[model samples]
Target: MSKTGKSKHRFPEFTDADAWEQRRLGEVAEFAKGRGYSKKDICSEGTPIILYGRLYTNYETVINDVDTYTELQENSVLSSGDEVIVPSSGESAEDISRAAFVQNSGVILGGDLNIIKPNETIQSTFLAITLSNGSQQKELSKRAQGKSVVHLHNSDLKVVNLSFPTLPEQERIGAFFQTLDATIASHQRKHSQRRV
Candidate 1:
């Protein structure tokens, strides 16, 4: 479990693949903070919006659709469908470490969210998964400041090291997890219906 490029486990197909390369999260992505708007600005109808709290409460690794709406504010940040978002502040350090990929573009990104837009070298879903689990999550928790109200800034995220394989491999890995999440969601729906 020493910090290394090679993971203890990987997909069987990637067995012959090269060891993953380590890069700073900022090196492979551009960071931006979601602008304008807050819970008070939310509306019953308008532009779809994602507030920071939803990252931990309602979203998993990927957010393809949003349920919340808000009035479009000037200079508001919008998702490009390839951004990974993390809460800027949370009740605890562990809560602030959660990350989710925005898979639909044009959704308004509300305040208190740190958005990471990955370049061609990485997949958004894979990057979110990496940040939400393993070494990166622990690093983020350690970097988060404040006791009563934990905060994680983009500066703190920029320095964390992330290991990534080739783009094709990343896509395969992300797709696998995406499928798994879908299956789990479907089963949960079925279970909910059974209880009704």
Candidate 2:
């Protein structure tokens, strides 16, 4: 708010900081497409797996708790922290490119997903939120192709531009959202329990 009230990341710790820098999604990060797999490959008990389809129906803006597991194969590379999961295919433009942030490693990434690996320029949680931001989602929708199932490729994802603050500011903003999301989930659960 540097006297202009133009919106800035002003924390008491770094009150005199500059505004966030703008960059394309491709500049500070790379979108890696997850490997292919079939339902036949799924198992009742094994290593945890991040299925792309679940990005639509099962996840929130960010995911910290992953409970589903599948059989771990030699090629089933696990996800590392700071990687965001995005659906490659969906029934509509809005559903396409829906995202989730993976906070830890070890869960195997499955087919029809694009993993957003943000580098030092941005935090993974921040990147995830920006990817799912309304303007970005609209861009994704415009880039998405198909008839019944909308599809977004790595090439399509690279064009979305993002404005990010310093690492410290990103850390603060991302952590705040994480805490807020947890609180919202807690309230949602309490509300659901009352309904039951």
Which one is best on TM-score?
1
TM-score of 2: 0.87
Give lDDT tens digits, candidate 1, residues 1-196.
1234557777877764466888898888899999878789888899999999888767779998798998887898988789999999999999999899999999999889998999998899899888988999999999999989999999999999888888878999899989988999899889999999
- Model 2 ranges off by over 4 Å: 1-17
lDDT of the candidates, in the order given: 0.88, 0.77
Worst 10 residues of 1 by lDDT: 1-10
Clashing pairs in 2: none
Per-residue alpha-carbon lDDT of candidate 2 for residues 57-104, written as tens digits (9 for 90 to 100): 666767767767777777765788779888888898888856789887
Model 1 score (lDDT): 0.88
Best lDDT goes to which candidate?
1
